[model samples]
Each structure stands twice: as C-alpha cells, then as structure tokens.
Target: MMYTEENKKEVILFGYGKFGRHMYHHLSQGGHHVKLATMVESNYEEASADRIKDIKRFNPKHNDSIRMLGINPAKHLLYCAMEHTSNNLFLVLSLRELYHDAMIVAISNSEENTRKLKYAGADTVIDIYEASAQHLVTNLTKPAVAEAISTIFFEKNNLKIAEILLESDTLLEGKHAAEIDFYGRGLILVAVIDREMGDELIYLSRGVDHKFDAGDTLVLAGKADDILSFKMELAGV
Candidate 1:
C-alpha cells in the first residue's frame, strides 16, 4: 500500500469548503473520479443542498449532489479539507480507524495544526499559506519552472511533467534520446537526474547522445498517455 508520486488515485474529498473544491477540480482534471462528502448535522436535506450549491459554484454543469459516508472506504485517497482544522483531524482519525491502508491527505491552517494532522495519521499535510508562499517564491526565482508547474496544475489539458525511474536492466538505460526517437513517441525528455552525481537534475537541451544510467530519473513533459508509453518502453514491456 505504499503510494508513490507516480501512483494515480481515486479521491474522495471529505468536505465542501473552498480548499475541498479546489482539490476536487485538480483531482478531476488529473483523470481521477472524485466524490464529495460532508459531516451530517442538523437537517440532512439542508446540508446536502448547501453542499450541492458549493459544488455548482465551481462546476455549473454538475447536477450531482454530494453524498454522505456510504463511499467504499478502502483503496481511495481520502482528502480532509474541512475549513476547521480540528474537524479535519477528527475525520482523519475516524477514517484511519476504518480503512487502515487508505491514503489520507489533510490541509492545515497553522504550523501547530500541521504537526497535529500528521500525528493524527494524515499521510500528507499541506498548509495553504505555506504552499501559496512557496508558489510565489518559485514564480519569483524560477519563472520558467513556475510556468511549467502552472501549466500542469492550472491547465485542463492532459499535458504534464512526469518522472520515471530507470531500473538497472531497463532498455532505456544506455540508449540516447535520438536512438529512441522521442519525437515519434509523443514526448520530450526534459532532464536527467543522475544518481551518481548527487542526484542533480540536468536539463537536456541537447540529449540526442545523452546516455541514461541505472537509477537515473528521467523528467519528461508531455501528454499523460505518452509518458505512460515511455515508462513502459523503459521497462521493455
């Protein structure tokens, strides 16, 4: 049940707040089925209506309403984006109690809350303020990289930057980029992070003759399907 950056997950967003909606959009755009749930309080019909309104504000064409906790709890990425950090922590605790292998991601409001969320068994805890500040810094320092990130996160297309690790016996280990014909494969090899060289990511502006090594990570930017094909080729499958 170890989740890696390469693993695509079906998400169940556990709130209808601003951050929850934001996560929903990103997950859906990333080709994941996302479901919404909210804590039931007071009148069930009223709470469901409120959640539906929040969803429609983002997706006007969406007519489906958020449901309660009837979702199959296992094998899903559970996102706890409740506006209240304490409530999110409680939800994480409850989810962990039910689904031991579920990947729970939570958002935190403060540094203390981030620690608390992690302690409460959230696999990943993100602080909105800190993430926003980091995005601002990247935009300021590395505009080109920031633009690439924005294209992946903000754009609705399937274009994205993906990383693939080469195994010792991979077919792509010692082949040059031109030998593999990246242009024909519908992708561009962006960079190579050499493991022997302290894992420094070297951008390949001219990698026709660049030889890949075992354990070297390939950074590519292209359509998601093309990236999958490249990974499969690397594995000689």
Candidate 2:
C-alpha cells in the first residue's frame, strides 16, 4: 500500500524492551509513525533516537504522565509490550481509564495473563507463548508455509494475515472449503477455525476439506485489497 501522511497511523509504543523494540521496528518499517516510550532511562537511551520522532518517559502510576505524551486516543494506536506482565496490565488499565475508547494492543506471556489483560481493558491481547508455539509447529510440520507467512508479515509486502468471520449471510456458508477458489481470488486460505469442532483450527495445508459454516473464521494470507474484495464478494456487498 502506498502510504501518505494522511493515511499513516501514529503508533505509541510503551516499553523499549525486547518485544517493544520488535514492535517499534515492525511498525516503523510498515510506514507508520512510531514513538517510543519507556520507564527506564537506559532503554530510552538505547533506542534508535534518530529514526523515532519522539521518545518520552512515562510512569504507569501517574495518569498525567501519559497525558503529557499528547496521545490522541482516536488517531493513535497504542502498544503495551512491556517485558513484565504486571507493567503491561497496569499500562493497559491506566490507558483505558484515561482514554476509554483508545485502541490498546497488549502482549501476554501466558494464557492466564491473556485473560487478565483482556479484563484490564486491552482491546487486543496477543499471547506470546501461543504465537511462538504456533510458529514452531508450522516450521516443524510445514516449512514452506511457515516461510510464506514469515515473508508476508516480516518482509516488505502488502500481504497480511487476517481472520475473516463467516456470517450467516455469507455466500460461502454452505459450500465446501475445496469448492471455493481462494487462489483464484488472490488469497491463500491457511486454515479454518471450525465452530462445529469446538473452534479448532484445521489447517488447509493438510488437504482437509471443510464445509463452511456461520461463525467459522477463515485464516487467510493476501494483499489488503484482495482480502477486502473477497469479503465484499462473499457478503454480496
């Protein structure tokens, strides 16, 4: 996608730790304006100050400290990727309290913390162990598919992995997965989270044919435009 100043999102990333740094780099490379915030002075000093527009110190306990950062909740995407689960939870809670409608994405180290983070008002919670394990499993079982996913996400590509929920009115609801021509539509159907199978993700790489149903989520990798077009076509929009 061609990024212009008006189209680019402003990203506010808290904590300059490992995960924070990774997100900063990823967001920056994706053409979004990224600002790094950390509680530790050393982390602030270690960050790439030249590339980032602003680096500020924020205190999780102080609401005013966050306000001082001048984050516009509606326009900015906030990331709480601190190394400690406590800090992430507190950051999410504090941010939610300050900006009730802010979009906050937090990282959790465990399933228990994932639930806590969601309850703490995080808009999205990424489970670190679950994500890492999924990647490991994919690499072990299907190296080629793993590489494709990595290239789409990590490389300079407009392709992205998105979960498209099948609503009741979708045209594909009653069709078999193999009957739909995803590749012809410029999309790769990676897996399907079958609602009938207790939301179990059945990987399509194994050549399994699944009957599409409402409430099932299709995991697809493709360009943003193609994905949007596919959804629109499926919904007959």
Candidate 3:
C-alpha cells in the first residue's frame, strides 16, 4: 500500500501560527494550494487572511469540529498549532483515525509530542527545536555554502542545479570547457567543477578555460527539465 505524493490534490494546514505560516509560504511558492483551519476566526484573520484563503473553520477544544475537518481530509494535512499546549498528544490521537489517505505532517516542539504524533499515524513529525538548532549551526559554520544550497533547494523559481560527481570512460576527462560545446549541452551556468588542476585549483565557469578532471562534480543551472535531461545525456556521454 504505497501512498503516492500527489501534488495536484489539495492540502489542509492546521494552525495559523508562526511555524504554520512559514510552511505555508514554502509550499505555496512550490505551487501548492493550501487551506487553513484554526480554533477561531479571529486568530485566522490575525494571521493575515489576505495571503491565504480556502480556510476551513475548526477548534482544537471541540472534538466534533476537528473531526469534521478530518472526515474528508485534504490530500495533505499538517498540524502545527500544538506548541502552546501540554497535552498535544491527545489532540493527535483525536484526529488520527478520522482521515482517509491523507499524508499528515505534524510539527511539535517536544520530543514526546513527536513520538505521539508518529504513533497517531502522522506521516512525518518535525521537531521545532531540533530544526532550529540545525539551522543555527549551518548559519554559523557554512554561511556561503548554506546560501548557495538555499538558492538551489528552497527557491523554486531559480534555475540552479547541484549534481554529484560522475566518472565514466565516455566523458571528456581532462578537457577545458572552452573545447566543449555548452550550447549543445544546454546549460546556462556550469558554475563549479571539482578538479585538481595542480596549484591553479580549476573551478569551471571561471571563464571556461580551466580543464575538467576525471571525477569532478559539475554545478550547473538551467530549467529543471533541461538540467534533468542534461544529466541523463551526460550519463551516456
């Protein structure tokens, strides 16, 4: 019984709180239509109703109201309103058995609540403190690399591509980029190529004169489809 991650279906995100807002922004930018549910209509408006609509009204205190939202659950659901509560486990158990084939993503600050969310059938449980800690570490230790990764992974509209190093007999092992026809490969940016160019330290797209090593990772940029096809074609080459 595999659950296909279908992007075409609707997603319902509970809790119009801070973490919920952040997740909504990410998914929305990734082109997901998100519907929100809140305990009160006032809290919903306070969270900025204009940025998002398609909200379903519900309250955490009222079991019936939560059940109503769960009965015909949206294809994807994320519960993020439990941060202020001590008995968040009870709420997860309350809504667990009611949803259909929906993928439930729960966000919790406590490890105990994460366990409860998993036990109650949440597909994924995110720990708030843990995520924050990791983010802090990255921001401190690797700011530049982190920014590059964010540009590629988080910014959906950007045409940045990060790829693993590949070595094959067919590839042009020790050739300069000026020798290769990049237009035929259809890459807008061959940003970096991992290479051991003696003391010169060859990085690609530094004007394309540097030679490529046999086992060098090549960072590139293009439309998602184009980059994918380039990788496939390069695999054969």
**Global lDDT scores for all candidate models:** 0.71, 0.86, 0.63
**After superposition, candidate 2 runs with Cα above 4 Å error:** 1-7, 48-53, 158-237
Q: lDDT by residue for model 3 over 1-237, one digit each (tens)?
A: 111133234667776667667777666665666777766566578656555656677766677787676545544555555445443555566666565466677888878878867887777788989877877789899998777656765665535454536575535567766776766766654554455643333455355565666666666655566666666666783
TM-score of each: 0.63, 0.68, 0.58
Candidate 2 local lDDT, 1-237, one digit each (tens): 323344468889998888898888878877898888998877878885545558988898899999999989988999999989999899999999999989999999899999999999998999988999999999999999999878787666677777788899788989998899998989999899999899578997777788999999998888878988887897898
lDDT of 1 by residue, 24-112 (tens): 66776666667666553422244366454322111111213222344455657788888678778877777766667778899998899
lDDT, ranked from best to worst: 2, 1, 3
- The alpha-carbon lDDT assigned to residue 79 of candidate 3 equals 55
* Deviation from native of the Cα of residue 42 in model 1, angstroms: 8.3
What are the clash counts of all predictions, listed in order? 0, 0, 0
TM-score of 1: 0.63
Ten consecutive residues with minimal summed lDDT in candidate 1?
Answer: 54-63
The best candidate in terms of lDDT: 2
